[model samples]
Target: MTPTSLELSTLGHRIRHQRVSHGLTLDELGERVGVAGSQLSLIENGKREPKLSLLQAIAAETGVQVTDLLSTEPPNRRAALEIELERAQHGSVFRQLGIAPVKVTKSMTDETIESLLGLHRELQRREREAIATPEEARRANTELRLKMRDVDNYLGDIEKLAEKQLKSAGHVSGALTHRTVSIMAEQLGFELIYVSDLPHSARSVTDLENGRIYLPPASIPGGHGLRSMALQAMAHRLLGHQRPTDYADFLQQRLEINYFAAACLMPETASVAFLAQAKKDRNLAVEDFRDAFGTTHESAGMRLTNLATRHLDIPLHFLRVDGSGAITRVYENDGLPLPMDVTGAVDGQIACRKWSARSAFDEQNRTTEHYQYTDTPAGTFWCSTQTGTTAEGEFSITVGVPFDDAKWFRGRETQKRATSTCPDESCCRRPSTDLAERWTGKAWPSARVHMQMFSPLPRGVFPGVDDNEVYEFLDRHM
Candidate 1:
């Protein structure tokens, strides 16, 4: 574009940005700059260009640098782009991305400028890739979790097939015994081996070439949980799921297989009836469900969500967060807003420290469940959480219901109450002044933030994470 044309747009953009950031109306800004509001509008809209002296006066009145309002350099492509990037970096909207401002200067080396340009190009490329940005990826996962949760964690087709298989195996009870699980494996002609010496990381690897499924001791040291390990392996064969093409598909298929395995262990019809009765005695506790069906508390909590949404007609929310307050799994149908990313998912996002889910880890009392009531801008919710130490260090499982819906829960009358404006100002992200003042020097938490931790890349990278292991496993299976 010509210098005159460029100057008009540049001056308008800078003036409008400075005015909006200062929260001044067109009339107020025009009055300060000694111009009529209508005339200022024409200039801001680029229909009229201001003289250099007038631009300098306007910049002075608006508390902006004169260089920002006028093209101090020629209107070349490189200069124009550098100016635009600088303008965006200074604007509130772009700064809100939480990125440190990288100031570009005419004195910078050509190599340094090229690097910055390369970074911008890479960011554009990321948009074409699936699930752009860490925030959006998190939101997408959260959305999927809730969508699967709403239907009571049931997949009709898969559940039907599972039910048929179990019924044929003469297994339709509270919990499918290990013996029954083993019997089904035998029926399928897959060799079952109980070895005392199995790799801790290897959870029943299926070898199609050898046709064998190996299991470790029922209870291994160092918190290697055995719950559903065999069933999860068996699910691979029963579900007949091939390798998924993309990460999202991989995630969905993995959860579906897990749900299918749970269906086999606690069959829908029986588990729902048990949960229904448990709710009747005003003892809708997840531990009761766990005891009645021989499932782990995490499994029990998920099962409760499934059966409750399907049979009890109660809308609920569930969350599983690790010790670092990272949300691993989350689902809600109660209309209470949870933290979400650009894609509208809450997974992999940090949970507020004051919320029941995150605070439950602080109690360190796994013997009894902790309950709290919190109010958000959207609505108030009553939540219950339990923390336990397992193979994966400490983790918390929490469930919540809306205030109106809390009446249906057992501990709705708990005197403990807290308010949360999560993912908003004045929440866990930015605590009260007193808290920071009190804990700032006393507490030394190493965030240890790593970029790789945010990646949704699949695990099972043993010894060396090169492609060799995957190739070997595929060859054996083939």
Candidate 2:
């Protein structure tokens, strides 16, 4: 990697930390420094560089002087070597010298180094455009999320369309019932099937011409994943989405479909009213709301974010993390800064062990709720999380609000706090010096697949379904 690119990540990380430390949202900081909030967001994410004047203003406002922002020590031997290899890939000098650069991060486990090297090779050739690695995909997605800043992460048009459709389906103004879901499907000319042998490539599928939808058996072990999958299939037909041209549009489209599916499952009017009542009762636990709506924890958590940002005006963030500690999905609307990797947003990157989502993996029961406070360079955020295990793997669903806003929710009472400065050296870059002195080449030997970090999240063509399988199934149906 070029030093400039590396500097971008480092600079963004520090400035974001400083901004959050000052308890200033991007909008507030932008107002203070006279830059657009969207531009500030990109600068904070390391995707954009600030002008000299803007940099001066940022230094004055955030107290992170220019030198500190620009200064990033060269990467450790491992990362430095990787960069040198990338730089020499086409260099005539390296070609003459035969200076083969081995792909590895000396500090990380061998497996991770391999996975990253694999990703680097995959994207090393093609010209960059939206889709390359999971990180690039997330960067594109984050940019889309940032665009919604003006609308507070609420796509009002999509939400309004969903409500109007729900009303026409006779769910005019109440909680959506499974019976009502069945009714809506029939009204849309779809026949729903609960199948025991549906291929594993998808959670659900639809045969539009045949007017049939397929779902896994209800007895399947795991979170209520099938519910959302089935609804998403229904949504594809209802929303009339054209084929997406690229991953960014694909991701953006799925988010809209998810909004539609959630509206159908939780129905905005009643869900909002119920949440309002729950807020009054100081019982905003997501589990209770999931139970109340008979939805899965993931769906419940997503709906909570929607309600918080769009309806309640509560400003919140949501995280869906794998048991392995990778952030599978993130929705950040609350102004708290999220740390991103050199590749992109936190997606597919390992979360700090100190994060609530990471801790949720340790819960005894697969479904018990976890509540905790996480203190980051940004600010403290109170979070409620729960685990859900499926055939795919166990993952955590977490919803958090900034510390200042936590008082309105029930989980604010958590005394446990985790300190984190992620994507930073102190977080996980090196072995603990004291612990290392004792073990020092004695017992640290393990290598699991951090492969999730390098894999692309297959979305768009079908949310959870593999795109190839979707095409095959549709072909067979026709």
Candidate 3:
């Protein structure tokens, strides 16, 4: 294996220690090893990777074995400090400061190096703390979303695991039943318990010691919410996830558990077969898929994005926009022009007013899905949006594909069409010239600021979760 920088530094320190003990100068060692003195100096300073042959020659000249030259341990405390300082200098945290790195010299005292290392540690801690901010969270979400897009949002390992769990629970076909979910939990040595006193900050809490999965008594309006939450809790165990190290790691775990839950709710083998047949019949619809899987409209739509692109070769986008038109959740691989902030994050950005996701709010028939074809700077795309209400407020779940792939969907014939020029101020953000002239210097609207905008993300083992509340709840039950 190729040696890491730290390993090289350790090896170099060991070689230099041996040379010093033998009372040999660089020239004397180099002459004995058949290498230039300057080259030997570079090797001794860990500035160059030495070949196996060179290492063997050096070991022979120093009266030691090759393994001794390759030892990972630093020769002395000074060597350890130097290796650490070297690593800190090359780190991203130091590089981003745009300042010259402090060079380690033979004259520098160990105490000075220790103080520098302490400062470096403090800088690293502050940097990690900064990542818990909302802007950093958004940036991390954007990066994860883009990565999911690149992979077509499909995860085969989770899919296979879900399928295996379902089969083990004796789920052969149809919608996965509550009994089957219970059985699956039981098989995993967990008993699903309904309780009225779940922690306010937690959706569900798994008590590993008691082998109980405590859930709220009331089910969410859509059928799959409770099961999905339970499965997500179980996923933490099945996926072998540890406490997240950073905000990015926490976001990743959230995505993974959600993915695992969706996979369990909609088994890939069965769901794909059902969708494939639907596609063949040219009757693919989100509502139909939702009915078949007995999942929420949002879950069905998101699941389609996961499977459709990978299995059916149809690239698409999905969006979940709140009543005020903020893009709460979005995934696009079809070149849909989404409004993004300076950090390339689209979560808080407003969706175009003319797009179906926003227009669906004004539809008279809230019972049915609103379908439309929208022309934008990127291209024409068809979308079907379903608006629903929760405790939070009304939100719309939308699934759309490019114009060419629209023919394969049920809402392809809808004559409802609109145009959007988003990311352009004139499209929706800016007022008309007449309206601007009339309202300017007169309008002093008080903007309602969300508290989350000002607050730092919760600090603890789990972000946003009250650890005390959770521990208390577990104690009450245990």
Which candidate number would show the highest TM-score if scored against the true structure? 3
Count of backbone clashes, every candidate in sequence: 1, 0, 0
lDDT of 3: 0.89
lDDT of 2 by residue, 323-416 (tens): 7787888878775556676644667667778888887777677657888988888888889888887778988888998888777788778788
Clashing pairs in 2: none
Provide the lowest-lDDT 10-residue window in model 1: 457-466
On a 0 to 100 scale, what is the lDDT of residue 430 in model 3? 96
As a whole number from 0 to 100, the lDDT of residue 435 in candidate 1 is 86
Clashes of 2: 0
Cα TM-score of candidate 2:
0.64
**Model 2 CA lDDT for position 391:** 78
> Residue 271: error of model 3 in Å?
1.0
Q: List the candidate 1 regions with Cα displacement exceeding 4 Å.
A: 1-143, 149-152, 196-202, 219-227, 431-447, 450-478
Candidate 1 lDDT, tens digit per residue, 143-216? Answer: 67767865666678877877887887788676677677777777777766666645444555666667777677
Q: lDDT of all the models against the reference?
A: 0.70, 0.72, 0.89
Give the alpha carbon lDDT tens digit for every residue of 1-478 in model 3: 7778788788889989999999999999999988998998888888889999989988888789998888787878999998898999889999999989998888999999999999998888667545576777788899999999989999889998888888999999888777888998999999999899989999999999989999988464545778888889889999999978788899899999999999988899889999999999888899999999888899999999999999999999999999989999999999999999999999978999999999999998898888999999999999999999888999999999999999888978999999898878899889999999999999889999887678877765577677789999999987
Give TM-scores for every candidate, taking all chains together and pairing residue i with residue i.
Answer: 0.63, 0.64, 0.75
